[model samples]
Target: MKYGKTLVNDVKTTLKVLVLFVPLPIFWALYDQQGSGWTFQATRMDGYIGFYTILPDQMQVINPLLILIFIPLFTYLIYPAFAKCNFLKTPLQRMVCGGLLTAASFGISAGVSFALEATEPSLPTEGNCQIRIYNPLDCNAILTAEPYIKNQDIKTMGYTNLDIPNVYGEKVVDFSITGCDGKINYQTGSNLSVIEKETLFYYMLPDSFVRGQDDIERDENGLPKIRTLVNKRVEDFNLTYSDSEKDVLNLPSNDDSLFSINPGSYKVQSFPKELKFYLGGVYTVLVSLDNNNDVQNVEYYEVTQPNSVHILWLIPQYVVITAGEIMFSITGLEFSYSQAPVTMKSVLTAAFLLTTAIGNLIIVIIESAKIFEKQSEDFLLYAGLMVLDMILFGLMAMKYKYINMEQNSDNEELENKSERKESNAIDNPTFKHNDDDA
Candidate 1:
């Protein structure tokens, strides 16, 4: 009971100091994301900006470099100016502000992540061919990926899927490739459309087909014509099948399958409404776009896959996070040193570092679960939690009784004055003469 009473007294006295440590863990979590969250985000981004190519790992350099620059800039230039205004008067106030800023940075990151989702979209794996007909009319031409099949079975997976005849029962279809006219500077992965009664396409190709080379032969339209791609010629109709459905798959009639191709350009752009491309295909998700037949020059938007995100987008996040780090990390270290009792200073420093390890442990646990599927959602959660933590810290900080170092200063002054007096006495001529006589 006596020890318990003493412990209560210690807690009562040091509650303010303990509360300050709360935000430190959250700060570390945000700081560490530069290595994990942000790095992976950059992997999906277009890294090339003009002359330089910044890899995903290289994005981490922004964090440390910003920390180095912001610390001095804030300490010498910004803090003093704020100090004069009496705005950030105490350590607690600064820490709360830092927490808020960290939250804001994550919020900004969340927004950017939403924008990225549009370009690199996911597909719904419902069926074999998931055609998301967002609008059939506007898309007069479909931008299909260049044909190159990687299959070992020549008889099964081949160009035989395109066996549909026209209304006249003749094997002639409205197949035409409109070369990119100078009018539209369509980038690779950009969407174009064509209007026909029905169009059948082969999304898959036989392994025997040549991938690197394009088989070109032009029709009267001056557009590059698609030569009928045949893998293994069907020389023998008498074929053996182990599986019952094998005959239906091996012998192509007039229908669509997972391997059937759609009409579109090799160059494409993904949009909001996306259909699931085949699992192991280059095109993961596809958006079917159509035009509204309004009279005045119909303007269609194209969202293309950028090779790299402009490195400039990283600035706001880096700036806000660094600001938080400067305030939380640097100030916390100084606080742990100055506020701790002289004998317990080492113990306090270790305690401060332990918070960082705890923060990392939290991240490891969260990542291991793979709880949040979308990275954007994960960042949003980080932002929200950070804000809530800041609010709690602020309340604690407001009640904190800042430690007084005046007594320590007074003791140092007394020791310095006594040493000066002793020096003066030793220098006195009378004292020196007496010592000589003795």
Candidate 2:
């Protein structure tokens, strides 16, 4: 009877210890999803919804909701099935089932990733292109104008002609070329030569002309003779010959000159042709049009391409991470309580709960460090912290030993016996007291 009573007490104690550790680990595992799986999943989602952006951290609520809804169901339905199945009687069997489920969840997410990747943009098409062009101008506006010649003649010799204005409104004499309609006339007393008029259009000259001193040939009177007549009369000069030589001399003079001419006003007849160009296979010029009626200028451009696949790759990683959370966090809580002595069961449960709280606090600290700061660097720091945690957990696993309640009974009994002895000594004192005095 005593043996049966001790066995029943041992079972009760084991159950009580399991109860403390079991819930804490589960809660920890559920909480850990916020950092791992949820975080990874959120990277793939459109955070913005009609100008209302959803933070990745806020998605963590899903894990807690799942826990709240499923914990009781598992306790009532799934736990009973494990107990009745006989095949899953051992804790290792239960752990294996949990691991398989976790892995299966990850597998499902991997399938989702594959599907997402299949839909991802592979080449430059609509929805993935970004192109922006600044202000555009007409090509005709940049073309230089052709040069021409003009001439004027003073019929009476030795009389200065004045008030004659060039096309640019500059007062100057004019020179003309003797062409098919006009012939050169030379007299014995004074010979006449046809001179060319120089028409100045838009021209750009260097500043060196302004910096240097004027170099001109002078007559015996010390006054400079006109080596180049800007605008002069062809009839006033003496001509020795006529032919291509005279025509060559009549050509407009080429000199470094600067002047602003009115731009040619012409209505653009058609739109500019699109320039078909490619920037990698993933990016191309989609549509371009000259909306301004300037055929030489492109006023509108539209570039398109497929969306990126980076987000698709993140979802599977999230699921695997979430699975790890279930295994390490929830299972660790169960293990903590099961290993603890009956007297310290509450402390073990608290320890299990503390790990999750610490994980959450670490996340808060990391986020706070970036509060009011721009995210310039990649999130490698957070990744490093996770790696550190995994390493620490692995080290702990190496040193950890499962608690065996059956073997710990002697220690519990010793503690109980010591307590009973102390209590008896306190109740029945060996020394003579007030009764002996009476």
lDDT of each: 0.50, 0.35
Writing each residue's lDDT as its tens digit, candidate 1 over 331-416 gives: 77887777765545676788899888988887887778887988898898888888888898888777776666556546646876
Q: Give me the runs in candidate 1 sitting further than 4 Å from their true place.
A: 1-16, 122-124, 128-308, 369-371, 406-438
User: Best by TM-score, which number?
Assistant: 1
**lDDT per residue, candidate 2, 1-438, as tens digits?**
355444565566555544433223332333354466445444433343433444445655555555665566655776678678674444434444454444344445445445433543223122221111111111111111112122322121111111212223222232222221112221111111111222111111111101111121111111111111111222233211112222111222222122111111111123333222111112111111233311232221212221223333444444444544444455556665667666656766776667567556655665667742322121333333344444444444444445686578786678778867976874446766787675
**What is the alpha-carbon RMSD of candidate 2 to the true structure?**
26.3
TM-score of each: 0.55, 0.34
